[model samples]
Target chain A: MFFRVVLGMVLAVASCGAMAALQIEITGGINQGQAIAVLPFEQPAEVKVDVAAVVDADLMRSGKFSPLPRSGMPTGMAKDEELLKADAEVAVTGRVYKEGGAYQVEYRIVALKGADRGKLLGHFKGAAPLDLMRQAAHRVSDRVYETLTGQKGCFRTRIAYILRRDGAPFPYQLMTADYDGYNETAVLKSTQPLMTPSWSPDGRRLVYVSFEGRRPAIFVHDIFTRQRTRLASYPGLNSSPSWSPDGSKIAMTLSKDGQPDIYYYDLGSKQLVRVTQNQAIDTEPTWSADSRSLYFTSERGGKAQIYRHDFATGKNERVTYQGKMNLSARSIPGSNAIIVITQQNGYRVARMDVDGSIYMLTTSSLDESPSVAPNGSMVIYATVYNGRKGLAIVSADGRFKANLPSSSGEISSPTWGPALDK
Target chain B: MMLMAVAAAMSIAGCSTTSGSGAGAEGYDGQGVVTGIDSDGAMTVGDPNEVQTYNGPESLREKNTIYFNFDSDQILDAYVGTMQSHAQFLRNNPDAKIVIEGHTDERGTPEYNIALGERRARSVARYMQNLGVDVGQLSIVSYGEEKPADPTHSEAAWSKNRRAVINY
Candidate 1:
């Protein structure tokens, strides 16, 4: 089910980019996608593995191009000439072998007929259980996308979410895994409870809500160090801690002011300034790319909707009105669009042009908490699956969809980290 | 808040109900605040200098607990009526030390349940404080949703779990 959505997008992408970027034979109908082939990989001493099929699956998810199947290739042509005769604009070839208890794989892209001919676009060597065979494929696919279209691809990004375990009493933990739902790791844990796992801009740490001592408090945990520090413990309520773009401060919702309202706390100064004084439920704060304005959901208008608050002017404006309830609003980087969860006939997540045009993402699901990737190409959010709460990610244009598929009991409230600094 | 409301109503209920009849318990249960009855149905609640006392009912010995609504930290309206007796007992015994533990059901996010639990505990603490218990002497801790008196996954179990127990 997930593969099909992405596969459809791969077709759309291949056509769009081929028409705009490549001066290929543009037919009366949509360009029938760039036909790409995967030549058998080079074998290193002692390691013999070819990962052409994995690359095929990776690229097809982008709705970009259809890879000529392994069975379709006639066995005799030279690797170079075979790709050329097939009209393949780009070719993916890789080498995989095992050494020192780890798998090493190198991915490459060779342009068949273009200005940049036989280009060694990308190379990655790593260990396995990793879907290395698959990621190796995505790396090559990304290379082709970048080499021809000149734009970065988000196939390698990972998402972090909160999951409840099935142990004696529920254990809520923060989990981080790849976009394809592989290689998962627990970021934080709690016996009392945990919610809202948000990633730092640099992807080095996580900030989330925890009930460690039976009080709703926020903790900042360093992924590498495995150490955590309490950031807030107000007497009444402290929640929805969100990081500013520059990672300087966190904007959150605190009810210590007699009612739930938006508040901004300076990470450096240790001072908190109440941002929203309304007596209504105001929460789910997110930052604009520049950190100049804050977007959040407030029920001041009688129902939850997206609103913008400018720090410089101390003025506010309503940004979403099409839905009766627009709880989560996250701005996609480099685009004027904000992914928000709207409840019209039913609850669903949609990407809306900051002004108002909405592109519905999930058709049937109880979706909430949408977080846009740093690149703004995809949005990850929380929803229920099989009656088990979980997280879902989809391309910004709604071309691809995937569930984090946590082994833990259920998952929710995911926030995308800024790209990994390393 | 509902807890405080409980303590207030308990005091009001004391005036309406006649003195209770129970061995060694009536004095602390249904009695008034100023002059408390001892276990013998005698005034045990004394003034500040005398460790002031009140006569409580024997029935209250089994009812030291309070109940909360589903997904709510707010004390139930029924609690105010019963808690008024507790406020009277506290007034009668100024030196008595009491602890309130807040709890919640298994539903909702854990963080949310914890917050809801604290509010429920505070509700009781505030009520007691308003009814003349020294704020400094009263201590409150939120157990969040950690310990449940009943382990059933049903709403019945959850309602019973969302509670604040007064321990002296």
Candidate 2:
């Protein structure tokens, strides 16, 4: 049994001219988000991007905070008491000004109407060049979000996905962009298809499947260096590469010996170790947060279900029973809960708890490839919207939803990059 | 009507193998080029020279793509004759090569679909090998649900999308 929340306004920002980047449109309403006000940042006219708006969008997209509209906000530097009068539990105030060749940003999160009332929860200052002003704004949002929600913000992270233009000479492109679908860049392009991009634990490299040679092969590409190395090009399939949390090994699916099975390729030893020995199809390997086990999709029981392979015991156990088909089980960071694609009315994105309880996260029919954010607050997946293939994001609790559709063509196989070191 | 056409094509194929000049078969121009049949049973030839020497019946050549039921890779009894025709063609032309590309409907996870596609392609390949087609002449690749024959989201489209293509 699941409760459907009221859908929110569809904020469709029309693309200017031929902009091909994905545009984020918040499409679900906030069910239980805390009310907060992000005041307009006082900045000079030379600053092009609205720093406070970026922060406001970041917090709002997380589905944990509902930022008050700027028109209703009290004018200029409202105190905690004034914010409380405006029915805001917290207020974020900031200012941006030119400091030499860089832009200086200073922001504060003030608590209202609590034991810590009229107190500064957090105050942070940072500077970045004009081009990176948006990232600096996201940092402010990160601090404010963590201070209020007790969870790290994923706004500063990146996501890699495959974009297929219908009739281009090189249609398939592996692209990465900011968490909010900004700063899009193609890391690799090919005439053949690309699939299942898994980020490295250090967020430097991506392991993905490509069909450039007319057969499926896995390749590890360094994001910063633009260097690509063929990781697994066996005779059969070499797909579904997942970096372990410890950054020591990558769990993948290889079919060189026989049917598709799980294998771990150690980075230090450069040796491949088989994990599953079943005759059924075993693919889409995802590592647990502790790196103690791997959760992968297997068809041993006549239907695709999630199975866990423990390293210590060397045993494989079935992990899901609620759905007739449950595939692509990705463990939520820092928890045992997993985001899986389950067949209900249609294929949907759901979160399965340790106790085997399923909480539906998406209501769409063809939702697949659910990738959890680093903080486990949101999930990004590919789905069909308005009869076209596009990517969507939903809150982990299913309270908020948004669409990140490309300006042209289709996008799929989205993998959220790991939180990188600053 | 379809069964009658298939029967007529089969007899013509029997004549072509025995008489060696069945160029008068429907959809064959007698110039070593075989026309392709679309979903609507219409024959089309993109370029006569691109098609290789297909000594099989025109119906068998038209049956290069075989459909499957949802989530199942078992070759249907309906396509057995088509598989036999292709296998015989391969056995006759030992140097000929073919790629078995598998696909699925856009329903489950893409990675799982990839595996499912591979299983379907392997099923077709195994069937051909059992029918005396050389294993070295066949290669397999799975496009999963990435490439669909029909991009629509209905059952009709899905039935068409869940298929394995035998590319000669």
Candidate 3:
């Protein structure tokens, strides 16, 4: 079932690019997207990949832009008259040139209003080899997105996920890749189950559960150094390690006290601070943007629902009422709303404001592990497609939805890494 | 009936699939695959692929596993005899040490499932202790939603997955 779908999508993606990046199948989006034109980038023969097309696709897939086809674009440069005729409101023209064996790309965006020659809105420049076409294109796309939307773009961020293959030596493999699922590299492989990967604030380390010791144990792994340090493995379960906002502590669920409850592991002191003393299950801890409160899933109210615990007051209150069961609530960076996997029509992902306004984001029956991008533009979650677990992405507003399916095995605990600054 | 109501309540919330019970695989009884022989005369039960020996008592394998309802850890009345027999086997073998692995169907959050699975295993351990089984002979671990008896998403598969198996 998995391979058949992959083959079908591969044939459909043959038109997109040479290598098969994440074959995104957008299920839902706005009817009338914004009009933008990305002109063909002038590049030397050394640059094999098309940078302009990548930028165009990124904008188009965002469910925000309807990029005009290159054939319909003007001959040399789009004038206001030509763009207006083509129904394009904005235009992106760029050139990729080599200098001293390194490549340099510069883009100029024009706002085509009423005038004959459109006024240049902004100029963005990037330097990399022709081999780094994807990164260059992402840079251009980020600039274009910021200029149009007045918000930071997360095109350069990385996402870490777990791939579990049944017969593979390392059945559970931790992998990291670009936000679009390209350039995926396996960071660690283990014979035991690996899950709940949470990225540190700096994006250099990930703390997750590795069952290598014949039991659940939390391990903090540095991405670049390939070094791992055991964080928590006290008597029972040492799972659900979520990094705090300041990277000083990790809030996790431990059953060392005979029942699973929330605890914070201070990185400096290496001491566990008990957060919740309730008899009910208190797990899946995520810190607020300010790090003053934690939003976690609890069964204290009979069934699973999201709850907020303020550290200063030592008071926790149930936050979600619409869903009978709500779990895996992740705070959107710099936002008041949290993206949670709520029980609606079979565990769909939804964004809920602190005031309790809910906006459903997915159409799948089984969706879990929602991680928002650093810019709070998109939420990536794991969903069951054809009974095989895979990752699906939805825009923050629930307008755009796309599937990021792997070739094989189940995908889980997708942690969107911090934004890589330019 | 209360367990069924709770399972139904879980389904009505649009949370997950139907709740089920009992093993659904063909030729696979409650007897788990024999992973290896123990220091004692008992055998270690684990994944079928890791099964090394078939020389152990078939009755021990058959009575070692107890299934549960979805999201509920209540051991069914049908498994009472099995649990009693296992408790007797432990009492008869003083040197035997058994690891009770708790598991859950892939319906809820992984963290919660771990807690739920642990509760189920603890319930079993407590039950055996009441039946005069030595508490020192029993060790508990939970695979949560990690290891599934049946990987499919249907209720039949889930019913089998939500279980606690005693491995020597």
Candidate maximizing lDDT = 2
Reference-based TM-score of each model: 0.66, 0.86, 0.85
Error of 1 at B20 (Å): 49
User: What is the DockQ (computed on Cα atoms) for candidate 1?
Assistant: 0.04
Poorly placed runs, candidate 3 (over 4 Å): A1-21, A30-33, A61-63, A68-71, A74-81, A113-117, B1-57
Tens-digit per-residue lDDT, B1-168, candidate 1: 111111111121212111212223322212222222222222222121221122234656676789977655566778886677777877777776666778887554333444466667778988887777777657666656545677445568777898998766
Each candidate's fnat, listed in order, reads 0.03, 0.28, 0.18
Residue A182's lDDT within candidate 2 is 75
How would you order the candidates by DockQ, starting with the best?
Answer: 2, 3, 1
**Predicted structure 1, TM vs. truth:** 0.66
A361: Cα error in model 2, Å: 1.1
lDDT of each: 0.61, 0.78, 0.75
Backbone clash count for every predicted candidate, in the order shown = 41, 1, 0
Model 2 chain A lDDT-worst window of ten: A10-19
Ranking by TM-score: 2, 3, 1
| Better by lDDT, candidate 3 or 1 | 3
Model 2 clash pairs are A8-A29
State the RMSD for candidate 3.
10.2
